[model samples]
Target: MGSDGSSSGVVREPLDYVGVTNRTSSGFSLIWDSPEEKYKNFVVTSKDVGKDEALKPKSTNKDSEDDSEKEFDNKEEEAKYEQTNKSESENPRSKDENRVPESVSTPDPQNKSGTGSKPVTGSITSFKKVLPGSSRFFQFEDLPPQTEYTVTLLGKGPGLLSRLHKLVISTGPEPPKDLVFSEVTENSLTVSWTKPKSPISGFKVTYTSIKDGEPVSVSIDRGDSTLGLSQLSPGSSYEVSVVSILGLDESDPITDFFMTLPDPPTDLRAVNVTDTKALLLWRPALAAVDKYAIVYGSGTDSELRVTVSANAAEQQLSGLQGSTTYTVTISSQLGSNESSEASTSFTTTSGSGGDGDGFGDLQSKDVTPRTARLSWKPPTKPAGSYRLTYQTEGQEVKEVVVDGSVTELNLSRLHPSSRYTVQLQAESGGRNTAPLSTHFTTDCSQELLNGILKSGEVDIFPQGRSGPPVMVYCDMETDGGGWTVFQRRKDGSVDFFRGWKEYIKGFGSLSGEFWLGLDNLYNLTSMTKMTLRVDLRDQDEATFAKYSTFELVKRNYKLIVGGYSGTA
Candidate 1:
């Protein structure tokens, strides 16, 4: 090595790079960088210096190298020399600073030996060799383990004196044994090993994933024989190798394999919840896992688990009790080991609105030829509203929305003797109650009487009027049952019996509602038309003068009127 701007000469012109490389216990490799210009020859010397020789003060008498050997022979002076050498290296004189300049500097004397022991400068073997400049490596074989060695290099050039290069290096400790898993967690693991019998600097751990690529490595202090490995893959197997490092070298790698449990599932949540069923959704573990287990139950119920395939993102849980709260947990598994569980809880909604047996005691009353009245008792659980729907046979249904309190409704315009079906239901909370249905038929007596009167023979005033007949309203119940009319000829005969039915049928347009002149009743004296007011409830026969529906035929017909009428 050359001194910094102090000494103008060069030692082998200073190597491009020079140190120990590929070192191990029992042996180490010494390498020196080749120079730009090749040398004809080179020499490597390894000296086995005793501890006493290395610790003794250097010979201040430049005249005698033999004085250095003599100082090591005296035990008491050797101890005093050891202390003085330490002080001189710490506060070196200007003369010593000028020797190597900044190219050489001592390590901290406090850490002169790594474990506070006196550091030696040699191994048991001494090697000296003169080899060609082509040589790049010198392997010092079968050296003592954990011993320090001082190596010197010299290169011979043309017309140049070979210069000396010095380096000190130590061999590594022995390899560790019986490395194994001491503790494990989801994302971390602890590895333990037997401490090497020989001293060591630290432990170097290199781990490889059983599932993927290149091994990862780390270094830890020697005091921690059991070291924890973190940032490890969950649910994965790995092979880890532990090596002991001494000084700047490492021992052989000792390997052990281990597996870590998978991490818990993430982003747990629930969706599509119902009274009796729910769907649970979650994100699968990022790492590889074999399967998943889903466990769910209410606080008061026994929990149950369902196994699902890996990569599944959701599960449907059914048969849940209505209006209940439940807790659910999701866990991922790799073989028999399962990761810590991820959990979520939710409450179900109340059961959906239902239809019950409402609208009871349904009936139809006050039946008529064309109308009916319906009534019913309110249901036990009255709803917000009611729907009353009714229909004749083969007709579209008609419905009325009513308050729940309404129990009676009038259904009108029904055909005589035709059957109608009525349905009733309660409505509450946007739901419909069970329907109560019943059947009803209108009274047929009115139609039967109407037909009888219509079938009678027709009689006309012989003016050939083809237009529709004049109209009149009939109270079939009162008029037809009593069956009377103010029908009589001037000659007084029962022949007006035919007039009761026939003339009444011609009064279809209500033309018989006006007054009748009894002063000259039935006078056929140049009248264009005539009307009759009739009421037959007086219990009269065919000769009755005031009947509800009465009729006749004659020439020059004049209008006549009787009972149930006002002034003309």
Candidate 2:
């Protein structure tokens, strides 16, 4: 290379040189010729510059060079150091009032090493280099930006035990103010702040729960990006704070806030019914106000309406088709204010003609000793089923439901002499007809029979105390004898017996056993004791005879009369 500069400044000495024998890709030679060698020698790649002459200061140090180096160092420091804290007081100390102006102006770099020289620039009112091995809390203030101010540094040991040190302070810009965290949620949050007119990136949030004793930090990316706060439990309160991470500066911490989630609703219910109208009723919700919306249909035809109010306990919806089922729902309008809808179903009732004979005027007839026949007329319309019920006095009803129309019913198991009421109701198309009642009684009159008298039976005799006593029994031992009796007469006249008169006055009483009977008559057996009497009568006279024993047997018998015959 040739020199183009002027006079004496141009002759820079050229050192004795040797040519390289081996070359590298970087255009550097690993081997150089040695002046005393006939062979080549290799240059050491790893060299140690020991603490001897190697560290000696360059003898040609220049004020301009030192100025340039210092300037370059200042620029590098400017790029690396950022303001993290800005201390402010309304009134600043006057220069004359300051004990030392230059010593307390810069903050110590929290992390310092020999690799670089970065001065924390802002005047410190009181500075303590947390000794290389020790840490202690410190406080200070800085003047407002653009203000010409001087600061002094005085180091105090822990617990104010050590003397003040002569430390220097420098100034560049104040650090950014603390960041604020608000509207924190399980997964994300909003951060806000004002920087100290210094450079900085966006803010970050560091959080931990009581469960996670250790804190976890998140860098809040700009532009509403969602930070994953996933896997968090609902209804839990979390401690969270935000901090601003300046380019290469310290982080600033803010105060913490908490948040929680809402709970779910419980005990939902619904009930459905069918009248001419189909209505739905339900128990109210505790977590939210609910409105009822009915959805009614069979399979394909359906209708929905939200006409029901929150305060209304019951609602009637009309114009329903017969035998049709409808589904109903009660729900909430707002999502956060919502609950699960309750569901129910019902079938509409059918209509009946006012004059269904099968259900009108039930009548019980054809009564017997143990049963009664109940009869009714058929209904005008067809029925799905029929229910006939009856009851005794103060007794439960006996009921039967049949599939078809049954007009006449037989009710057995009735008491012999009892009355019963029968009621009939008809069910058609899910509707029940009105009931009718009638009463009937069973009969009891076939309980009387005839009795007969036999032999060994005795008969009671009639009293013979009349004017001419008659005999009830007589001796029948004679050849032509059967049961015979005698009449008596008081007058003694020959002509008294002239016509149709018996005149015998005396006849001995027969003592032998005899039979007494009459035509169209059977034996009489109720007579416990008996007596015999005889009566003999003529036209004017009559006599009486008495027997010692009375006979009562079923045979022809003869009787004796008194010993006189008036007619002869």
- lDDT by candidate, in order shown: 0.56, 0.36
Q: Please list the Cα RMSD from the true structure of every candidate, rounded to 1 decimal place.
A: 41.1, 50.0
For model 1, what is the C-alpha lDDT against the true structure? 0.56
Count of backbone collisions within predicted model 2: 44
Specify the highest-TM-score model's number. Answer: 1
**Residue 286, candidate 2: how far off, in angstroms?**
16
Which digits, one per residue and each the tens of the lDDT, describe model 1 over residues 388-474? 888765678898999887888988866654556666767777886555555555532223222334321222122112222211233
Cα distance off (Å), candidate 1, residue 368: 68
List ranges where model 2 is wrong by over 4 Å: 1-138, 141-197, 210-214, 222-231, 247-249, 266-568
For residue 559, give model 1's deviation from the true position in Å: 99
